[model samples]
Target: MAPSRAYVPSILLLRSLLRPLPRQCSLSHRLPSAPSRPKSKTAKSRIRKPDPQPVDFIQRGISDKPGDDVLNESGVSAVEWWEEDASGNERFVSAITNRDELRKHEEQHKRLEAWSRGEEDPNEPEFRNMVIDELKKNPSFSDMQDALEAMKKPLIERIQEGEEVDKEIEAEDEMSKEEGIREAQEFLQNLLEEPSLEHRRDQILEIQAKLTEWNSVDHPEFLEAMARLNEATGGESVEEFQNRLNPYLDIEHTALGSEEEISPQDKAEMEKLAKGIADIHDLLKEGGMDPELEAEFAEMRREIGTDDWATDVFAEDGEIDLDKLERAIAKFDQAELAEAKQEAKDEDDEEDLSPEERANPELKAKIDRIMEDPRLMERLAVIKQILTGTKAFVSNVKSAPDPTTLPLAHMTTLEDQLKIAENDPEHLIALRRLRVNLLPPYNDHPFLRPFNEALRFAYVGANDDVRRVLWRSYLKAKTIPGLIENIPDDAWDILWYSQAVDWASNQNRFNHLKILQKDLASIGRDGPPTQSVGGVDVNEA
Candidate 1:
């Protein structure tokens, strides 16, 4: 029935809350409003109508619009320009047709501006962070990284193993070299113990045969042994043996072997010149003149007699008898020519003589008596065989491969041989020849394992007497041709230190530690110090 007025108002408010809201039209679908005309003082102001545009209507039954189904099926409500959604959010309308494209362009422009300012782009992927994130999420990527680490670990181990193997090989090589040296020494000692020269020669031949079998015919020790055998068998001194082998030993002579030989006439002229110079020196010394002036006067005397000759030439102080001096020189020349001719004749006669005829008559008769005895004849035949064998041994050595072209193993063997023969003066020529040949090439050879091996053989392997000789030779050489000038600083340091240690160990006077300290201090003060040790510059030595 008729309730209170407050109850009626409450009922009406409830009814209003239950009523449905009207559907809103999208801004795109709504008709545009006409623009208002401006007011004029005259009442004749008229509004102009806008031109008509084409209209597109929606088809209901089967829609042809590409995105119509997606929007409808997804239950997306149309948002009007001024209307709010159920969530009470206001809708926005932009003038830009492609707002997303415009936003992308703006972002790109911002990136460009940031780049121009040398600032990192905000959108740029952080590679380290991305890698870390990938490692976290992607098990396969982590596995791949672990695999790479595992591979690297094995590679490092292999390199270390290879280095160890190289060290082992070097040690083995050193051991083998020492063994070979010992064997060679034993062979030499055995040969020395043989009482007879014939037996010694036979032992040397056997050694040579063994060396040939081992492909070490070019071994330095064998060459040296052959040299000694030649000297002994040929009844010659070391100098004579060296002189005979000069054609082979001399680098220049060997290099020039293929060239035209020097004419006998040229040799004779050279001899004459040399003899004349020597005679002039002798004459100067006898006359109490300065020996230093000898060379100057020798040249002058050969061209136009010296002032000393002027004294002998002049009869009066100013008036010189040049014709008489010329006659005397002519006579001297004739005498020299006659003497040379006589010598040549004598040599020819000597060459034509039989061995028995050439010998002293008494010696020849004794030899004949000895020949009658079978025992003596047998001994002579044995001696002849020894001489032949020794000559053959020398020939083999001469014909062997060039030491410079030898393999590292062979070169090492030769070095060992040189060490073995270092104490023997008889092998000096062989040592020098090998040293000269080997030094230049080995000094800078790429394949040389121990770079200073050749230098050690030359300087350290030698005895004290030989070392002194070598130092003297180095000093007197002024320059050794073909020596590598651009030797590494480290190489020089190693060589110098090794030599210093060797010297200190040998000589009781020096304290090696102090010497080393002094050198190190000098090096620190002035880079690569050029201090001298035992009268030799560190670098030069």
Candidate 2:
């Protein structure tokens, strides 16, 4: 329905030919008049542009506006235009009407051109000046500048100062080591010369202080002095010195391990002592059992008639049947009364014997033989000392200010006695008695508290066998609810030191120690549900 493009040129040519030529005769008449006279003086000519017309209304759907259709189709409101000035030179009119927008565009264009030329933009100077002005308005700007200036120092000078500081530290460390060695030597000399208990105690305290300051127990000079001191003190044969030196010594070697080869005479004496120790063990075991008490208990059981008496005594609602319990208690009282009467009768029979009859020849001969054997006599002396020490310990524990109170000095004395007892078979029995009597009711006492002073003392003063017992006790103590939370840092340090000693002595597996060390390192990092001290979890312990 539209005309073909090929006919458009011919149609335009026909229209141009149909147009009439304008009045050629009138042009010839006007041209003759204009050429008749030329101006006497030349004049400059000026061209003036007409004023722009103002429109009252704009049509929305007009198609005659140039580029309007294209702008509507592309969704653009306005575009840049070109306009002729009065001098007939073309000038560009930007679509943006805002002066600030026009200035920003001009700056962006300059920045792009500068970047292409690998040069800094001209606008950056003005921007940097503006930023500096803003920073100057801050209250602390001058103070910050001063601080930065003060912080500036030459690298060489700082390195030199650091080196000097390191030298001073090295000098101090050397002086400390020398002082510790000298003090330790003096202590050892005084202990060797005097060998008195009071002198030894004071010197030992000094040595301990020095060791603590040095932060190492494995110093060569200290170890040598300690060895000499131990020899002079009779190598754990003297209980006081053993207790004082135990925290610094290898417990396995000094307290528990076998001695080196001895002379035949000394060996004979040792074997005799060994026999005596075995006898003591047998005696203690026999003394622990009471046939009368056992027989009474058996009779009581018979009287109670083994028919789930507990159920009969306690009703379904957990109330005790008073009649049945009273009958059972009456039977127990009768058994105890009979036992008491029999004991009194035996005492009277003993009193009826004459003095000479009481001292039988067989018993006298046995006693005389024991007195003649020096080894047995010496063993008996040690046992007497152990008994005396145990009695003193019990007295001290009972005389404390309160059930939960134990003075440190008294605890030290008790620990010394325990160490002495631990070295002999008879002494171990006494230690067990102390544990049974004191540990249960007075557990809050510092010396008897679990994983505290008690465990530390046991580790230091007792042998491997006793340590195993204490460790088992410690593990058991952890099983009690709320007990783990009460464990202190010192307890974990002691345990870690014990494990370290065990590992060093090749008594513990390396993998076990490794796992323990890892767990200790992870304590505060990945904390477990249970409380931990020194990185060891109570549950794991």
Candidate 3:
């Protein structure tokens, strides 16, 4: 029993091998062998001689012979000339050499076919050994054979089905919960469009009861619909109803400790809602709905539902909606507007009186109040200063020339004309600041400063008729009107005057400027004041 020892090379042996590498052979140097053989069986494939060329390329000095010109003008030597051209000949010779392997494969195929058809004994030892060897070479064939046996059962019969489809249906049921919630919300939204609040409330209650059966109380939209339903119940806040429903709403709280008891405020709010709901039912039974009040209430509810009620309150359409306007007005102290109305009403009720009879202590008090207004006085002072200063500046200063006709130096000097403007920094800043609100065609020219200031004063006094002295002073001045008419159309200083007139007209300043008011009446603007500013043609004014 000779024990075979696989030994590693010793350092001396390795060294000897390394030394021999230069002399040759470490472990049989990379072995490559060349074969010389006889091809006598392929005599037809012998190299053929080329036909003689019409012109002797070699004699033409294109040959590689000594003294032959490599730079032949014909360029024939550029090609690889040789004694024999054997390109592509080897491919044919190779095909011919492979015939025996092709014959062996064909014979093997025929033998395999004969065995499969039982023409020969497939059970013979040689054939059995071959089949077994092939199976062993490809183990996947065995797996395929097993699969074929299994496929004997039809696919339809092989499929086992039961719990899988049921589980899928259950998953769909879970996924359809959102769809159900959406349907419920849509139903409630339809109820909101109902004309009768009581009917809407009844439908909402029914829908709410059905929704609870679906156990959709946990959804946000469901909670929101519930709040709306409580509102539709009429006369009740949702909080009040929720307080009454606290025992049920806080049922989840029962699971918590006593520390999580519902707050008293919540209970109070719920109580209020419950009482409101009952009151609404009784009121609906009474059947005398005030259209205006109900409309206003509905509008308030809509506003409360909006995301930006503050901005909506000031919106144009919102301001015009009677319901929203009434509700908004109801929220504020309307004493001022009421006082104005009462005064107007009282004046109308009074018997026709002379101008002396129209005068009273109250009239004097109004004048005193206007005079006492520090804001009014301050505005007047500002207007006076603006007028005086603007007059002085426009009179003394010269206008810039047409820069287009001037050279670069002259244009630069024209720009330097700012020295005159720069001397009045305060005026420039003030005028520029006021320019933002200047009427059209009236830019921030120094000449327009007086008019702008006067208009600003007039606007401030528009709400207080007694404080309109400054407005009248500017409007009634011959110099101002003359300046306005003679001004260029491009200058538009008249726009400010027109604006002041418009402000006065808007404020119904007839009591102060009876002449302008009469003019307005002639023009069909004698009715109550409107929010819109009537267009006043400056030329006509």
Model number with the top TM-score: 2
Clashes of each: 0, 0, 7
Of 1 and 3, the candidate ahead on TM-score is 1
- After TM-score superposition, the amount by which residue 348's alpha carbon in candidate 3 deviates from its true location, in angstroms, is 99
Q: Candidate 2, residues 315-392: lDDT per residue as tens digits?
A: 322223334333333444454465457657767687788876554465345435544766776854544454565556
lDDT of 3: 0.41
Report lDDT (CA) for all predictions: 0.42, 0.44, 0.41
Q: After superposition, how far is residue 21 of candidate 1 from its true place, in Å?
A: 93
- RMSD (Cα, Å) for all candidates, in order, is 34.9, 32.3, 40.3
Each model's TM-score, in the order given?
A: 0.16, 0.17, 0.14
User: lDDT by residue for model 3 over 1-541, one digit each (tens)?
Assistant: 9999999999998888878435563323333376335468575355343444523654555454433323233433223212322453322111112335445546767889997787976533345444544444343455575554343233222121213433643454444445445555565555566666655666576766667565643444555666766665654554443323312132121111111122366446434433332333223223333466456455655754653323233222111133343433333224335545766876875687676666466544654554465555443344345346555755876888788988875544322443333224342333233322222233343445654454434332333332343334334331221122222222232223333454412332222233433333432454223323664433332
User: Per the 3 Å backbone cut-off, how many clashing residue pairs does candidate 3 have?
Assistant: 7
Query: Residue-wise lDDT of candidate 1 within 1-541, one digit each (tens)?
Result: 9776653567778898999977874423444496445677453345434333322333342355335323344344342234465588765532222435445546655655766787843222232233334344443354577655553453345445545655754565455445544554554555556666654667566655666455332355656665667566554443433323211122211111111123366446434433433343333344244443445455545644444443332221122233443333344345446545765776869878887665356533543453365554343344345346555655766467898898866656545665545433334323332322223333344423233344445443544443333333322221222222223344344334443546421331122223333434432433233555454333322
Better of 1 and 2 by lDDT: 2
- Residue 373 miss distance in model 1 (angstroms): 60
- Check candidate 2 and list the clashing pairs: none
